[model samples]
Target: AQSVTQPDIHITVSEGASLELRCNYSYGATPYLFWYVQSPGQGLQLLLKYFSGDTLVQGIKGFEAEFKRSQSSFNLRKPSVHWSDAAEYFCAVGAFNQAGTALIFGKGTTLSVSS
Candidate 1:
């Protein structure tokens, strides 16, 4: 079984401040990692993913993450956050099986950005 956990339920940051959101996963084999952002009353948009190769992956909106195999963590980070960046962030893990494959999402962390 594969699972993902996002420790932060909510986070508040001022505009232009650095941000970091924690994520952890449990999987039998190497899992595909992904981060998505969802605005209120909107669907999720992919932020980034880690399939293979580089441990550090970059994404849209100036976001990036590092895959740590030992820690079983893939934490999201941004040097500076904007007010527009306020949204709910989800950490997900993708699993492959004969039946099918799907993403297992975390509870999500709501980000509140203030000016």
Candidate 2:
């Protein structure tokens, strides 16, 4: 079974400050890792993904993540966070199966940005 764990249930960051989110996964094999963000009442957007090749993947909005196979972790980081960045962030891992593809997601970590 594959599972993703995000230990933080909530995080607060001041505007223009840095941010980092932790993620850990368990899978039989190396899985595709991804980070997605969702606003208060909107759909989820892909923050970044690591399929193969470079362990460090760059994403939009100055976000990046490095996949650590040894630790089975992929942590998301941002040099500076904007108020608009306030949202629920989810760490997920995907795998291809006979049925097709499935993504296992963490509960989520809600980000609160303050002035």
Candidate 3:
């Protein structure tokens, strides 16, 4: 079975400050990892993904993540956060099945940004 855990339920950041969110996963084999952002009442948008190769992957909105095989971790990082960056972030892992592939998500981490 595959599962993901996001330790932080919520985080608050000041504008122009850096931010980081933690994530850990349990999987039998290498998993497809992804980070998604969702605004209030909005659908999720892909921030980044780690399908294969390159431990470090970059995505839109100036977000980046490093896939650490040893730690089984893929943490999101931003050098500086903006007020508009306030949103809910979810860490997900993709699993393959007979039907197809599906994403299993974490509880999510809400980010509050203040100016």
What ranges in model 1 sit over 4 Å off?
A: 98-100
lDDT per model, in order?
0.96, 0.94, 0.96
User: Which residue pairs clash in candidate 3?
Assistant: none
lDDT score, residue 74, model 2? 97
* Per-residue lDDT of model 2, residues 29-75, tens digit only: 87999999999889999999998999999999999999999999999
Give the worst 10-residue stretch by lDDT in candidate 1.
94-103
Predicted candidate 3 versus true structure: per-residue lDDT over 1-115, tens digit per residue: 8999999999999999999999999998889999999999999999999988999999999999999999999999999999999999999999765458789999999999988
State the lDDT at 89 in candidate 2. Answer: 99
Residue 49 of model 3 has an lDDT of 97
Q: Estimate each model's TM-score.
A: 0.96, 0.95, 0.96
Q: For every model in order, what is the number of clashing pairs?
A: 0, 0, 0
Clashing pairs in 1: none
Top-down TM-score ranking: 1, 3, 2
The collision pairs in model 2 are: none
